[model samples]
Target: MFEFSLRQVALCGQQPWEEPGELAEPPSDLAAVIGTNGDQFRDSFTRLCLYLARTYDDAPQTRTDDTVVIGTEYGNTEALTRLQLGALADGKMLSAKHFPNATSSSASAFVNIGIGATGRNLTLNAGLLTPVIAIWQALYALAADRSSTSKVLVGDVYSAEALLDAKREANGLRCRSGLTHATFVKGREFRADFDFTADHEAVVTLGAQIGSDKSIDRNGAFVTADFLDVIQKLDVGEQSVLTCRGPLARRGALTVTRQNFDTVGNGGLGE
Candidate 1:
């Protein structure tokens, strides 16, 4: 019922570090810039928030009163890996570390670290629809008069091995490890449609067409058809529609970016 548009989007990936490539040194004060790392998910998650905070800091379009909603499907994996290897020594860990080279400071606070105290919220296991869901959540809140202004943050992180394993195990398919983010703002219009086939397969449309122009831009190769099919498998008897106007949702529709692994879905891509 609420309409919205994406304001900004920032995404990160572990594959760049996994494979050989030139890299930039992050500020030594990364701990200060972004909150200290808790684990892979938290660190990568923090980086996402940090990038948005820094990039949009002085933008006239963004405000201190904006709201935030974070969506992720990798929360379980993040929590699981953190518990399994949070304190393990170098060789004992599953892969290369992506956080700061120092210990975390318990005294540190995330109170306005990036997006500020704009009533940020989080949603886990939000599926591929996370980014949009986050935007919708913020807009819905505003429409209900729950908040004066809203800004949304949505991101996801994955482990190389575990990501591929889950994909294969789920449906004998393969996937890669990557993280994504999307920030949204209030918009002027919205639309949606849904129906069921005679055979009862649910079909739905979020917008009249995919917004390839207004989406977060990225480079990579992925299976578009597979993703479309995956989305339709929402449930046995449910269908929904969603549509939006504005620069964010009307341009490039949300896409799968950062294809850091192979299509085999097997463990051949990375360690």
Candidate 2:
């Protein structure tokens, strides 16, 4: 079992077709760190990342060694779609700025750069299971190095265009345009575990143990966001667990317990 601590959590949900004018401008410090004028990208995915990254930077608990992990179903598809359409229309490439943003990892890369984290950085895609899996990977990275005190920023983002494409491609399956972020540090108060099994019974048994009242069934794109909500509501000495079952029969479980800060050692919960 891997144990960790929750340092901070931030979530942003964009209304369908939300206008760029309504979005908040990125802070000057954040814009400087990200090397953007805060109006360079009109895509919801990058804008959401900048918003969350600003929150992370403003938090006092943030560390320089913190690792960044992002998961997405469809990443910056708007940039790619626009690139394709522009090229097809005139047989000429679109603006060079959109080229780098076309990749799935671009948003996370922006976060990593903005935050100045030198630790492991990764971006994962696992359909609906992306967020939970990203959380699992973050915990594992912390566990891999016991002396490391860095927190992990695990996040997920889906652009408006990506959500639209997902809805149309998945037989009208429900999809949301939003982003979620949570920072975790290694600790002895929480347990993070993962399992791989094709049997539905295994997931049911684990899910039941985690407690149905606290359990969040994999329903939509906001699984991680919902989990973060539960984590933030936990009181000191209280604990809660959430389990997610992936399409490939992979199960990830996270149990978070808010412990008294006085009880924590000077090393900051790495014990």
Candidate 3:
């Protein structure tokens, strides 16, 4: 019923993956750690936006009137990694520029920047229900008739620079590289070239979880994405379950549910 996109690290040469849409190109200095926390943060967002642009073919003209919803377990750890120097800098633990982006909403800021959108911004605490809650809330905003075209950017980001042993003593778990996931949802209109046939079903459910955030991709002809804290991949038959933990890189899960009717046209997306 839904499609998924994911990014993560691996213990064995990493898992084989392909960024189906615009994310095929790798990020600048992504493999190498350079620049300030805000720079890295912006870079991460830029990479995601480039991928989204390519996948959805969005132009710079995309306005902010739409909405961007983002989530993260930790934010702007890079900025927090700044070293305190001299008596004046001793107390300033985090960078000022990166301070605004220090929350879970940073990803949404990147989405708006990449698409050149002037839309509503919504950020929330990290938990199992965060992304799903965001999806539902975005839908509600539209159902409540706030806007005609709404875009939901759901994902997470963490501080890579904050991984140092010394900083671990200072900030604890805040600096670890967390997961990043996002997708676009439109109101009342489906994109083109999307066809569902018997071949489209998936079986094994791919999963990613951290803190309260989680995502699962169910496989087979009948498939759906479950954004729950504990998403156990369903086995070949119903009830049977298999599980695998994902890496600490950019991760995402997406799904597209469709419905068809033989009669005058009344139906729901079959799960």
Compared with the true structure, the alpha-carbon lDDT of candidate 3 equals: 0.34
- The segments of candidate 3 whose C-alpha lies over 4 angstroms from its true place after superposition are 1-57, 60-64, 83-104, 158-257, 260-271
Q: lDDT by residue for model 2 over 212-236, one digit each (tens)? A: 6532222233456566566556667
TM-score of each: 0.48, 0.70, 0.45
The per-prediction tally of clashing pairs is 16, 0, 24
lDDT (Cα atoms) of all candidates against the true structure: 0.37, 0.54, 0.34
Whose TM-score is greatest here? 2
**Prediction RMSDs, each to the true structure:** 13.5, 6.3, 12.4
lDDT of 1 by residue, 1-271 (tens): 4443333334344343343111133335546655555434454444544554455334434436555454444433434455356557444554435332222210012323344544544443334344444455666676676655554444334445345444443322223333333333444322212221222224422222232322221111111212222223334233233222222223213321221222221111101
Error of 2 at 155 (Å): 6.5
* Candidate 2 regions with alpha-carbon error over 4 angstroms: 14-42, 57-63, 93-99, 146-161, 168-173, 201-221, 232-239, 246-250, 255-271
- For lDDT, candidate 1 versus 2, the one ahead is 2
Better of 2 and 3 by TM-score: 2
Query: What lDDT score goes with residue 114 in model 2?
Result: 62
Among these predictions, the greatest lDDT belongs to: 2
At residue 151, candidate 1 shows an lDDT of 46
